[model samples]
Target: MKITREVVQGLYKQTGTARVDTDVAASFQVGDTIQARNINPTGHTRLPRYIRGKKGSIATDNGVFKFADSLAHGAGTQPQHLYSVRFTAQEIWGGEAPAQDSLYIDLWDDYLEPA
Candidate 1:
């Protein structure tokens, strides 16, 4: 089913009704080295398997949004900052990748840590 603007607005409104703090500011800045947390969740997750434990640098702040990990499991939208991270193809693919290529990924705060 197509979710109309009203439906999206309704969901966004509900995001505030739970009394959860979804406005946590981003800790890392653009160009800071970061690594994706090597977590293995059994349920819904947005973290890609290939990027786990890999090192990268922050490219931009994507603002905050409802935490997908919690939202997938019916938990409150524990909002947190999101970012666009840039990783070398070699960092993700090892010797098989070209040095000139890079990959960009949008990740949440909980998924990253200083490298």
Candidate 2:
């Protein structure tokens, strides 16, 4: 089925009625170095395994959405900021990977901290 903005908004409106601290986005900007939090491996998570504890720079703001950590298990959709973070291949793989290669990942506000 084709999804529309109204459908997305309706979903959020129904599932994300709970409010959350969204001001965290104001602390980040493009090029800001951020470290992905090494959260305990448990339950469903959107944060990739390879990117845990890795440092990256904010590439873009992907706007606020329902926090996956909470939404995965019937918890209310606590809205939070999402951003595109760029990580060097060397940081993710190793020095032998490629000096100029990088990977971008979309991450939630709770999963990142100032590096």
Candidate 3:
């Protein structure tokens, strides 16, 4: 299917900021340890390849938002808690990486699990 200007405009009109104002349970919290679930999906995904399987700490709550993968597949919004997770550079790039360096990534509840 070819995408044109009209479809793009319609989508922007339908979905505003993509932030859903609704109450949803947060599976993890700030300072809590979490591991990014490692799954190579054959479809749309928000998780980055480098972040997968890496352990991190929840740095902030980004609140409930529509799930991107689901929405990309024509599924309705699946609002869920989003978090800013902090991972040590060393954890992702091995011991050679500086310990002081850290990377923060915004991840969804479904992409994380207790570490």
Model 2 lDDT per residue over 1-115, tens place = 7999988888866564334545544558888999999987579999988999999999998777778888887887868888899999999998899899999999988899999
| Model 1 lDDT tens row, 1-115 | 8999988888856444322345577789999999999999998999999999999999998777788889999997778877899999999999789989999998989999999
lDDT at position 19, candidate 3 = 88
Which one wins on lDDT?
3
Using TM-score as the measure, the top candidate is 3
Candidate 1 vs candidate 2, TM-score winner = 1
User: Quick one: ranking by lDDT, best first?
Assistant: 3, 1, 2
Ordered list by TM-score, greatest first: 3, 1, 2
Candidate 2 TM-score versus the reference: 0.76
TM-score of each: 0.79, 0.76, 0.86
Name the weakest run of 10 consecutive residues (lDDT summed) in model 1. 14-23
In candidate 2, how many Å is residue 44 off?
Answer: 0.5
Find the 10 residues in a row with the least total lDDT in model 2. 16-25
Candidate 1 matches the true fold with a TM-score of 0.79
TM-score, candidate number 3:
0.86
79 Cα displacement, candidate 2 (Å): 0.6
**Which one wins by TM-score: 1 or 3?**
3
